[model samples]
Target chain A: MNIIMSKTITYLQRVEFGDCDPAGIVWFPNFFRWIDAASRHFFIECGVPPWHETEKTTGVIGTPLVDTHARFVKTASYGDVLHVRVHVAEWRDKSFVQRYRIERVNPDKTGDEMTLIMECEEVRIFAARREDGAGIRALPIPAEIRALCS
Target chain B: MNIIMSKTITYLQRVEFGDCDPAGIVWFPNFFRWIDAASRHFFIECGVPPWHETEKTTGVIGTPLVDTHARFVKTASYGDVLHVRVHVAEWRDKSFVQRYRIERVNPDKTGDEMTLIMECEEVRIFAARREDGAGIRALPIPAEIRALCS
Candidate 1:
């Protein structure tokens, strides 16, 4: 069997004061925010059209997260430059797993050392608008979309 | 063995337009944000002092999440009033499990029907400032705090 590996994408951002809590460290929820953004960026970088366009033509509105697990490794603070490495780990019939590794550059360390801030794995589905127009339902993985991402 | 259940606290909030994405549904990370707020509200309702006070008195800074698992059940949109019910599920020596059930009232349905939007279970620890003040370290579960919550 020929196995194709999903492409990896790196998203970069600087931690801001508003992103930190009273403890002077980055608030945990902000990590989820960045991770979500990274997930979207990965798809966009892989040549997938925006969800709005897909919703019109392919009935695919967006990838909605169904399950997630996360682990926090180290603390980060304002002014820190962070990077989120994102990739699709697996593609199932109607769902896929996305993984993220968040890291921060260590200024005091030599030779480009980085500290791991957090890691997360999320299961998401290609969602289509429901007939009642109130919610969404999962759709089977589209071959074209999968080809573009892989 | 006698098992004592922790008291539950409900936090209510209104969804704002900014909390949503272009798809017009509530962004998933906003759920994590609300859950974090509900966790703190649970401690407040249980008579625990704010983290700053605890830091000075007991050296306990705040409860920081180490791990989490979440399942999104339904979609929500702006202007919806959401209720997050939170409680401690288990207490360990250095960490504890906090659970949240997020729901919304459905006016279109009769008899005060509510819709479950998501559920989450988080493992957190009461953290103390490290000696060098650069990061945090887990602390043993405080008896007084546990008693108040239970």
Candidate 2:
């Protein structure tokens, strides 16, 4: 079987004072915010059209997360710059797996040294307005969009 | 082996305007924030003192999440009232599993009927300041705290 490596995209994020909790560390939920942004950046970088544009043609609203698993590795504080590396780990019939590795860039490093802060994996589906208009429904992976991302 | 059933605690949360995303649904990360608060409320309702008070005697700072897995079942928007039911699912030597079931309260319902919104399971550790004070370290589950919670 031919193995195709998924393209990796890196998104930059800066830890702000409001992102930290009373512990003085970046509150864990903020990591999810950055990861969500990174997920969008990955698709945009891969040349996929914005969801609004795609919606006109395919009725696709957006990719919505259905499940997620995360592990907190190290703590981060305000003033730290984080690099969120993201990619599509796997593709399924109606859903896909997106993975992220967040790292803090250390200025004192001799070169390009960074510390791993957190890691997350999420299952998301391309959603469209439901028939009754009450909610959203998953759509099969779009061939054109998948081709662009893969 | 003997089994002990943990006391279940429910925390109330109201969806705020800022909690919703452009899709008009609760941004997924905000769910984690509510779950975290519910986790703390579980201990408090179970007769455990606040972390600040426990810190003085046991050096236990707080229960910090180490790993978490969550599944989003339904969408929620502002004006929705959520009931977050939380409980300790399992106890380990250094870490414990917390489970949460978030449901949306519907006024039209006859009784306590509610709609399921999300489910989450988290692994957290009782943490204390490390000797070097660089970061937190997991402490053995405090027997007294465990006794109270269980």
Best by DockQ: 1
TM-score each candidate. Answer: 0.94, 0.94
Name the weakest run of 10 consecutive residues (lDDT summed) in model 2 chain A: A20-29
lDDT of residue B93 for candidate 1:
96
Deviating ranges (above 4 Å) for candidate 1: A1-4, B1-3, B109-112
What pairs collide in candidate 1?
Answer: none
Task: Tell me the tens digit of each residue's lDDT in model 2 across A69-95.
Answer: 999999898999999999999999999
Give the Å error, residue B94, model 1: 1.1
| lDDT tens per residue, model 1, A15-79 | 99999988788889899889989998999999999888998999998898999999988899999
lDDT of every model, 2 decimals: 0.92, 0.90
Model 2 Cα shift for residue B105 (angstroms) = 1.9
